[model samples]
Target: MTATVAAPAIRVQGLVKSYGDLRVLRGVDFDVARGSVFALLGSNGAGKTTVVRILSTLLRSDAGTATVDGFDVAARPGEVRESISLTGQFAAVDEILTGRENLVLVARLRHLPDPGVVADDLLERFRLTDAAERRVATYSGGMRRRLDIAMSLIGDPPVIFLDEPTTGLDPQARLDVWAGIRALAERGTTVLLTTQYLDEAEQLADRIAILHGGRIIADGTLAELKRLLPPATVEYVEKQPSLEDVFLAIVGTDPDSEPADVITLEEQR
Candidate 1:
């Protein structure tokens, strides 16, 4: 007996997209294995969002093909939509509504049998139960982002697209979102994330593709990408005291002088 290979959750081949004469994606090719996180890394205007839009069926490509969960994005848009959820750079929650209301709204829109039940379940899952009744306006950035992702899961889609999910978040808030993303993959969901932060991709993605010049210049795991570069080289420089040290020394030598205001390293930058 022969074993069968599972189809990839996402597959793109020769995918091309353009607006007027400005081409975005150029022959980009990659595959995201089922039940794993695949990150697309690129600078602004490098076509990361274009790829997500194409895969989510929000935009049609000029040439080539993309499939999500075995459904063609262009040819079977409804089927593709049924299998995927998208959370773009900005959180889509209604500010006036409470977190619970937001989730219930999505569940109702999806025509779930019991919207309240689904909403409560997701609130528990995302650890938003305590804040479920609080207006989203009062939630922190991380809370709102978690609720945004929770809303996307209303229909339990097999694939999720998160475009710059942690953009503008503080370090702790970013880590919270990262934990949520990992939990999704742990439950067998396929995640495709686009991010500008290299460390975000390094910490979350099972595989990564670097987009440059409207094309995927590199694609592989972090280790694989590292292997593509020259071998590591390390050099150490002798320690030198900063301006703070010099100021402290001067102050100690001359107690008669008034103390200077403390300056942070960031202020120097």
Candidate 2:
């Protein structure tokens, strides 16, 4: 008997887009499996964002086809929008509103019943219950990002498109966002993430697609893609803690540090 394979939650084939004389996407194709994190990794100007914009129905592709939840993005734009939520590079949050109020606002916008209850539940889920009443302007970058992601969950859309979710965040804030993303996949939400940071993709994606010059040059699981490189030769090198290590040990920082201390300590070496 032949085994049947499940269809991807999102699919794209021969997708092409251009801005006047510039072609941002050239025959891009990929698949995002259900309940998985699929990362589109590339550097700046590699058309990662363009692909995202097209898939989310915010922009039309010049050619090819894309489907979300089996609904054609071009032919059925309404249904495509219904099946997905998009979070852009920077958090699109209202700075004046309290975190709790932001969640309630989104829930109400989606016309969900018991909006307050929904907001309360999400605040607890994202570990923002304590900061819920504080204005977003006063919250840390990580807190704002967490609340931003929390707001996107109001309607429980099946697929989420996160465009460089941690772009400007500090290390700790990035880690916090990473944890939230893991939680989303664990709960069966399909996440499509686009980022330029290799480590970010390494840390988050279940499968990765390397986009270069407007095309997918590589696509596979982390292990599968790594195998494309030349075989590694074993080498043993002494492991030593650098000055940054000692500095962190003396005073916790790198995230919050004294520039004077950094210069003084490193200069001594």
Candidate 3:
């Protein structure tokens, strides 16, 4: 059998960020193993994006140590930048360029000699081949989002930071992006995703950390976190079963069927 590597893809300790007087991140710490998917969840202003920015070398942390692929984000910023890619909250593709053109531009920026080959490969990988020649301005929201993520892969970085990757996508579009994220993690890319969507965190995260007030309130696997609260007893019914049917099956229903809120094990008193 071949030996497996033990080096972590990302590591951070005492990470802090501030804006004027408000301290955003207060001694944040986390480590992501190579080829794993780690998610950071938080409400707005929880410092999730600030953490990503610092790790990806887009912004400097006020005080901390951050490393990506074993390269220090501050002391070895050039190497750290070369080892990671970041897709911010917004889709950043050039609207005037065609899908193919946008990818080729990224390839060229990476100094790849055969930009056309890289563009063609990414177009097919992202299912954008048919629309490759079409202007990005005419693309749908999902298509633009796909192009944005595809561009991030031009350098094939070992680690990727996706900050609210599905923010504006429709439900179907959101699922498509989720699938793409899963594919990346499966292929040994370490992903640190930040999102407000609980469902997205539940779906793609191998390990999750919840941020509240700029600190990690909870951290664990989904089941571990859910177990922290009461167990959620999920029930299902076929056909036109009323909420009354569900409640009656669990707790005796009132004669009026009162249209009361259903309580799961988590919400039960």
The best candidate in terms of TM-score:
2
Give the higher-lDDT candidate: 1 or 3.
Answer: 1
lDDT of 2: 0.91
TM-score of predicted model 1?
0.86
What are the per-residue Cα lDDT tens digits for candidate 3 across 27-93? 8988888898899999988999999989988899999898899999999999988898999998999
**Relative to the true structure, how large is the alpha-carbon lDDT of every model?**
0.91, 0.91, 0.87
TM-score of each: 0.86, 0.90, 0.84
Model 2 per-residue lDDT at 213: 87
Model 3 residue 77 lDDT score: 93
Question: Which whole-number lDDT from 0 to 100 does residue 206 have in model 2?
Answer: 98
lDDT by residue (tens digit), candidate 1, 164-236: 9999986656867898999999999999999999999999999999999888899999999999989989989
Sorting all predicted structures by lDDT, with the top scorer first, yields: 1, 2, 3
Cα lDDT tens digits for candidate 2, 1-269: 99999899999999999999998898999999999999999999899999999999999999999999899999999999889999998888999999989989998899999999999999988888888888999988888888889988889999999999999886667877999999999999999999999989999999999999889999999999989999999999999987646645665543334544444646679
Off by over 4 Å in 2: 1-3, 240-269
Q: Could you arrange the candidates by TM-score from highest to lowest? A: 2, 1, 3
The clash number for model 3 is: 0
lDDT of predicted model 1: 0.91
